[model samples]
Target: MNNTLTNGLGLLSLVANTGRAHGVTELANMAELPKSHVHRLLQSLVEARYLEKDHQSRYSISVGALRLGRELLRNIPVRRMALPEMMQLVGEVKAALSLAAPFGHEAISIAHITPDGNLRGSMESLGSVLSAHASASGKLFLAYLPEDEVGEVLAQLDYSGGGPNAHRNAESLKAELPQIRARGYSINNLESGANMNSFAVPIHNQDGKVFAALGASAQANELSLKRIAELAPILLESVQRIESTIKEENP
Candidate 1:
C-alpha cells in the first residue's frame, strides 16, 4: 500500500460518500492527516479530474467521477445478464428480488424487482445501501471477504438502529460468518426491519471469488425459514446461470 496513493483514494471516497463539498481543513480533520498533505492530495485529485474545486475553494466530486461511476454501472455484466433469471425467480417465488454487490463496508443494490400482484411494502430500492451486519445480502458480502478485510469493515460499521435480532457488535457478527460460509448462504430473519425476512446466496466470478449476492426478501409472515429453505434451490440455480454467463463472456 503506497501511502500517497492510498491517501488520495481515501480522500476521493470521503468526498463521494458525503455528497457535500468540503474545505481542506475539514477534510484534513476528518481524515486525520496534516492540512498541507491533505491539500496536496486534493489538488492532485483535481488534476486527475476526480474532484473539482470551486471559487469558494470547497471541493466536490467532479463530473469526471460521475461519468466513471455511470460507465461502471452500465458495464456491470451481472446486472444485465441476471435480469431474465431474476424475473423467473420473482414469478416463481412472488417475492421481491435484488442483486447487490459489495461496496466498501456495505452491500449496494444495483437492481431490484417487485413480483406481480404487487407485494406491498417492499424495502429494497435501487442504490439503497444495506447494513453489512444486519441484512442477509450484506452479511453474505461480509462472509466472503478476506479475514483481515472483514475485520476492517467490522471496525468501521455503525451498529445502531437495526431490528431486534441485528448483531450489536463485531464479536457476534464474526461468530456467525463461519456458519454462513459453511452453508453457502445467509439469512436475515427480521434482523434489518420489522416483519422483514430475507436470504442470499453468493454469485461467483470467473476467478471463483464471490462477486455479488443474489437475494430475495418478503414480510416475515410470507417468508419463513422453511420457505427460504424451499426457495434456496431456485436462488442457487439462477446463481449458477449468472456465474456461467460471466465465465463464458470473460473467458
Candidate 2:
C-alpha cells in the first residue's frame, strides 16, 4: 500500500485502539505525524464516513466503520446457518442459547436465543463480549487454542472483577484446560456471574475445524453440572446439525 493510505490507516488504528475520541494534535503525537498531515487524513476519513469529527474537533470511529464490520460478519456462513439449529436447541433445552466466536482477546456473541419463560435471568446480547476465562464459550475457545496463544489472550484480561471462582492466573487456567479437552466441552459454574451456570460445546466447520462455540446458560439451581452433562448430547447434536448446514451452504 502507498504511504498515504498506510499513514491514514495508522492514524485510524491509533484512534480505534484508544477506544475514545481524539483530537488532531493527540492523534498526530501518538502516530508521530505532523499535525497538518494528521488533520488532512482525519478530514479525509470523516468525508469517507470512516470517522466522525465532533464540534470540538475530536474524532471517533463512525457508524460506517460498524457497517463495514457488520458486512464482513454477514459473509460468515456459521451464524446464518446455525440460527435455526440454535433456536431448536434452545427449545429442547428450555434455556438461553448463544453462538460465540473467538474475537481478539475475548469471545464475541454472534447469535442468542432465549426460550419464552419467566425463569430467564440477564442474558448475553448478540454482540456482547465476554471474558475468555470466565464464560463457558470463552473457555472452550481457550481450551482449543495453543497454550502460548491462550497465554497471550489471557494476558490482556483484567481478573480483578472476573468473579469469585474465576481463574486467578494463567498457570491456574492452563491446569484446567486438560479437563475441558477431555470432556470435549467446557462448563461455567458461577464463574461469570452469581448463581449462573453454563455449558458449551465446540462447533466445527467443513474442514472439521472448530469454528465457533455453542452454549446454553441458566440459573445454577436449575442446571447443575450433571444436568448439563445430560443435556450435552442434545447440544452436541445441535452442533452437528449446524456443522452440516455450514458445510452444505459453504461448499
Best by TM-score: 2
Tens digits of lDDT, candidate 1, 176-223:
999999988999998999789999999998999998999999999999
The per-residue C-alpha lDDT of model 1 at residue 184 equals 83
User: Judged by lDDT against the true structure, how good is candidate 2?
Assistant: 0.82
The prediction achieving the highest lDDT against the true structure is: 1
Expressed as tens digits, the lDDT of each residue in 200-223 for candidate 2 is 999987877777998888998988
Hey, what RMSD does candidate 2 come out at? Answer: 4.0
Q: List the pairs of residues colliding in candidate 2.
A: none
Model 2 regions lying over 4 Å from their true place = 1-21, 25-38, 117-124, 147-158
Q: Ten consecutive residues with minimal summed lDDT in candidate 2?
A: 115-124
> Model 1, residue 225: displacement in angstroms?
3.6
